[model samples]
Target: MIKTSFISKTVSELKPSGIRRFFDLAANMEGVISLGVGEPDFVTSWSVREAAILSLEQGHTSYTANAGLLELRREIADYMHKSFEVTYNPADEIIVTVGASQAIDIALRATVSPGEEVLIVEPSFVSYAPLVMLAGGIAKTIQTANENEFKLMPQQLEEAITPNTKAIMLCSPNNPTGTQLGKEDLIKLSQIVKKHDLLVISDEIYSELAYDESYTSMAAIEEMRERTIVINGFSKGFAMTGWRLGFVCAPADIASAMLKIHQYTMMCASTMAQYAALEALKNGGSDVEEMRSSYRRRRNYIVKSFNEIGLDCHTPGGAFYAFPSIRLTGLSSEEFAEKLLMEEKVAVVPGNVFGDSGEGHIRCSYATSMDQLQEAVKRIGRFIEKYKVE
Candidate 1:
């Protein structure tokens, strides 16, 4: 029998994400009403799909440049400018990645030295901590509260930063919580980060999906712009998750450094995905509007449904999730989710799937249809009611 060393231990000791565990459970079970996945209900836009097909038919299967196709990079540059008012040269300031997941991984690996600290706010997207650990960096989690609308308060941030801090991740329109960081919150953070001279990794994947207010990226700030790396993708905005296309925009030096790792690890993202993403940039605004409007409808209904269950949910300003506090049930987030699934056959991810700060909440995705939302609420209500009685 072979024994694994510390090299293998790094990967093995990593716990599988809770979202996948619940999903696998739901998959094997029949009659499950799921609000577990945080993806769009909408299909890939017609134009985007057509672009991919055309690329394939035109025999563009061969690899392009290591950075990516120049035209696609230009389209991405233009989209960033027109939509976010953020400018990049596209020639030297951007690198296409295999989804924002790979971008985050590459940025951390390239920038963070082993034994350095990467400050992450939680409950966060599950990938952050694990990825930091894999790169041999310390995953420093600063737990943000629901009372703050899950915003990373300046005090909390100040308390967390150390001399060894290499980077800090700010996920606005955050995963699980659906918390959108407004201008005021970001301005405060920008000031603090500048004082500390810390590198900022702003995950603005849901930049286009904010409901009450538009997103203000940390990189949008003048001083913070130089110190920040922006990660965005086609997944959240364009309903193109499977396409796995994302990009990173940073200062020329940072982009070049990130490109070295990206080139060595993933030569370039998919050729067809690049084509489809270009189409998303060119003509996908209306599709985004449609999905955003639909998600708003679902978000409103589910927030109401959760309130009716006596679970207090903060108003979600962006993304498709509602992170409702399940504290009233006297069950942990995992317990509530499990009992609901076992008894009512409805699947929702427990809040702790994100982090400890999420312990008393459960995350419900409004990315499903309204009819499904209605039925899932009914099942969830019944399950909670039964648990109360029991």
Candidate 2:
């Protein structure tokens, strides 16, 4: 054998996402009601998809700049300026990646050296910790409680920072939790980050989906802007997940470093996808607003349904998920999920999949339709009422 040990220990320690195994199981099973994945149920808007098709038809199929199409980057800059009041010199301040997922990976890989620490607030999306590890960074998770509405507190963030810290991976309008940070929290964090002279990888993929107030970007903070790399994409808000279009807006220096890594790894995001994303950014406001409204309706529906059926979930003001305390079942989060799946054929992610703080809870994505949401509730309620926890 040609050196099976060639894989580094840093890579070996990582596990694939726990969310996947359960989702694969649900995919194969017949008639399963999965509130499992956080994907948008809707397709990318017709106009956006048409733009991609138009690109292919027009034979604009060649590779774009490793940093991405200049027009798309310019559009992204304008979107930030107009929508979030953040400015970046698109030429060096932005780079388009395969998805926010790729932007995340590249950002971490670029910023983190081996043995450094990256602080993450949990329960967060599954990627942050493993991505940190792959970059030889240690992931230190700071727990956020449901009582605090799953928002990361400044005190908790302060305590988690250490001398070896490289960055804080922040996801607002956060996944699994649907918790969005307000101005006060972001300002507090900005102060702490500035005080410590730390870097911030701000994942704002769900930024446009905020229900209460428009989503806030850390890049909008004057002091934090230079230190922050903003990760967002055309997925959730634009209903364009499979299109694989995401962009990073950061200081030109950081974007330059990230682009170098990206050039060697993946030359560019798909050209057609870039074109489509540009169109979405340029003229897709109504599409985004429509999807956001639909998501809010579903959010309200799930919260009301779960509360009525005894799950004690709050109205998640952002994102498409509801993290409900299944603690009442006396079963741990995983245990509760396992029983629900086996008995009721309803699929929800175990909260602990996000982190230890997620124990005693389960995540149900309300991205499905009103009809399916109603069905999941009935089955789940029946399972909860009849099942015993030991």
Off by over 4 Å in 1: none
Q: Pairs clashing in candidate 1? A: none
Model 2, TM vs. native:
0.97
Candidate 1, residue 358: the lDDT equals 93
Q: How do the residues 29-111 of candidate 2 rate in per-residue lDDT, one tens digit apiece?
A: 88899999889998888888899999999999999999999999899999999989999888899999999999999999989
The models' CA-based lDDT, in order, is 0.90, 0.90
lDDT of 1 at 232: 94
TM-score result, candidate 1? 0.98
Tally clashes: model 2: 0
Q: Could you give candidate 1's per-residue lDDT for residues 106-206 as a string of tens digits?
A: 88888889899999999999999999999899999999998888888899999999999988998989998999889898889888889988999999999
Question: What TM-score, over all chains together, does every model reach?
Answer: 0.98, 0.97
